[model samples]
Target: MKVDIMKKRRTVLNGKPFSIVDDLTKMDLTERKKWAPQVKQLYDSGTRLRFSGGKWRDSAGKSYIFVFNLTLDKKGGVQKTNFNALDACLSYLDKFSLDDVWRTRNPLSSGFTWTSNIDNIRCRLDFFLISKKLVNKVNDCYFQPPLQSDHHIVILHCDISIEPRGPGYWKFNNSLLLDPAYIDLVNSLISNYSSDPHNSNQNPASFWEGLKFTIRNNTIRFSKLKANDSHIYEKNLIKKIAQLESDSISDENLLRELKDARSNLHLLYKNKLEGIMIRSKARWVEEGEQNSKYFLSLEKRNK
Candidate 1:
């Protein structure tokens, strides 16, 4: 029979929920009577984040996510034989390496779990730990009996967060899309400026270079220019401008990576790009009011 939570009676002591309130309150690890039965509850938290081994809470209240897959046909009997949860957890880590992104503390890092489900088949879980004792339930799944199908039918019910990572970022103005006439005007300006070097102490190509180079230096400049001919949209716009500037950063991939530095607009911020995004004068501090906003999304920083 599956473990049923609905039918159980919970004992709450001193405003905390525990596996066994009486057992947890009086924990004596050396004593067999106290230690043997509730051994799982007696964890010695180490250094900094004591519960760092598993998932932890996110800035938001939502739990971080962990995911992995497993192939368990080699493990013999299904019903009679008992499977180890620790082995399952290890197997999950092997399949999906969550540790790689966890250190960055991006939205992706979290821990995974595997437990037998109420259904006839074994199940896998992608959970985020909220605390040493609390965790967020994200992906709940179960497998079907290995009937005619080559593999078990696994049904996944997931609650994943897709945020600023989703598409549609702010766009630049279309006037920067250079054309033949604009190029001709730039060449015309170059001819005029270069021809009168004796009369004018200004740089020879200053006029043409100013139009071509300034567009990249300032996004606000792109908003003001008037397009005359070629109207480049995405990559084409970047390519055309780069060709004119000689040293232009028109690559979409590179552009996305430098979003935080280029603009305060980022999918998320990193420490290096933090204060650099700020662009100018503050109207002095206000008293008795909080200046920063904190959004709480729950997440686990492990697995």
Candidate 2:
């Protein structure tokens, strides 16, 4: 039965526009209409509908049609990320100043720029962000699947389209990936200090003192960053790391060239051997400051 359902649901949702049904109860009308408008239809389309309530508009000034759920299950993702990931995802949205904001693509529905499916045991906290900054765009959605009685949360991509209505649908922008700007903050803190190791490290006491500030400062920004596709983040990190490592060599000058080389090698070793270092250090080694200091002290002893 599970296999049959999976096969059918996959067939239903594939290449079709999907609506996000955060609340299953929304399907029951008459009851919900008594209180507020519920989701009439939703979908994952190749074209985003710039909506003003129930109506939509396009660049040509034609009415944009809001497409909706063609099947019971919607399109999205699933993964196991801890609260830290959740926090990061929020910071990502906040980078765009998009948290706690009420926005409407359609007249019937409006919600905060970000919403968290929070629970105590929570098993998992589902994360989502809706962006008006790029209206008619598929906002961020990160979902994780469940197994052996687990429930998978569906995530979305920023480039997703609303349902295509009438005429030929615009081709989906496969290359359109909006950088979750919150990631910029994390990378800024980490990479901007590439040459100066002292900047990124917290004062321990001061760091924790500012932990709330760092963690909750711009939650919307970080969360969106966290929710972004990991492949892109990983690729960019590799590029940035390479660029910084190159710059690092020049910054140290010839006097420290030999020393910098050794330090660089150590950092590489420490990162590649992070698993081993964490075991020996009884903590995760701070790749930049801690490793750099370790090498500098060793160089001094040798001299």
Candidate 3:
């Protein structure tokens, strides 16, 4: 059974949601009481979980995530039947609502999880799952044996700080030139500048500089007229939402208004993304397309 961890409580292959527990195979393994605490500690220590043997895709088309299970015998050895061990791990994850955080490549640099006894099958049995909130806080994780226990110790280097970023300048929307009013304003500025005798005898460099200054001021003025009001409106809506949240008693209508405002804000952001993608062509080009011969052909044609 497939599972969509983000939406459905049970597994779903794709978008559809369904629930049916599959058959289970009974096998001998250690109880959960012994190593649950240790597992939880590592899980909480910002260590991402990963599967050593197979590739499993998640709802986001991601193959690996922070999937982990621990069903070791009293002697700290994997059960004879590995299936039982795997089942235990899945059940534990469901019980705790834990998700995997596996990146594209394996994060382990060097580590020997279990010493091979027969055919030199040294498996990396020791795995961990890092909390998403603490993923950024972790700097590094690796195995270092012989510190205290015979089992390899997973060392994590974490140096995290909370700092506020300064407010950046807003981006200008060049597409505003499509508006007839904007075109007319540009034409009026150009005509007025041309008619001024002060600019008639100016040197080539000075004429270019004056033209640039006039265009810049005109753009800024139009931007303030069109964009600034919308920005202020969004900010005010945010402030209203915050005020409502802080209040001891919030009216239903006020809450609805806030939700509507947030929805509108989201729509505006969606439109902005679409506009940016349209203007900034090739920014989101697919892999292998960047260095393709097709780009060279286009450059030649343009020239």
Which of the numbered candidates is closest to the native, going by highest TM-score? Answer: 3
Instruction: Tell me the whole-model lDDT of each prediction, alpha carbons only.
Output: 0.31, 0.34, 0.46
**lDDT against true structure, model 3:** 0.46
What local lDDT does model 2 show for residue 63?
35
The sequence of per-residue lDDT tens digits that candidate 3 reaches over residues 194-282 is: 78899968987998799878977888888788778778876676555434433332467875875676577656655554554444453
Please give the range of 10 consecutive residues that has the lowest summed lDDT in model 3. 20-29
Q: lDDT: which is higher, 2 or 3?
A: 3
Q: What is the per-residue lDDT of model 1 for residues 157-246, given as tens digits with 9 covering 90 to 100?
A: 324333355543444433334546545655665566457655356564765566545443444433334322122222244333223222
- Candidate 2, residues 1-303: lDDT per residue as tens digits? 122232233212334443322321222443334322222322222211211121222223333212122121121223232344335434534543333222233333311111122221122222233434444454443333221122333335455434776743222221222545555655565444344555347566765455445434455455445537444644444344333322213343642553444354445444534433333443334534444445544434543
Each prediction's TM-score against the native?
0.19, 0.17, 0.33
- Can you tell me which runs of candidate 2 are displaced by over 4 Å? 1-30, 37-136, 139-142, 147-149, 157-303
Q: Against the correct fold, how does model 2 do in TM-score?
A: 0.17
Winning model by lDDT: 3
Residue 161 accuracy (lDDT) in model 3 = 41
Report the CA-based lDDT of candidate 2 relative to the real structure: 0.34
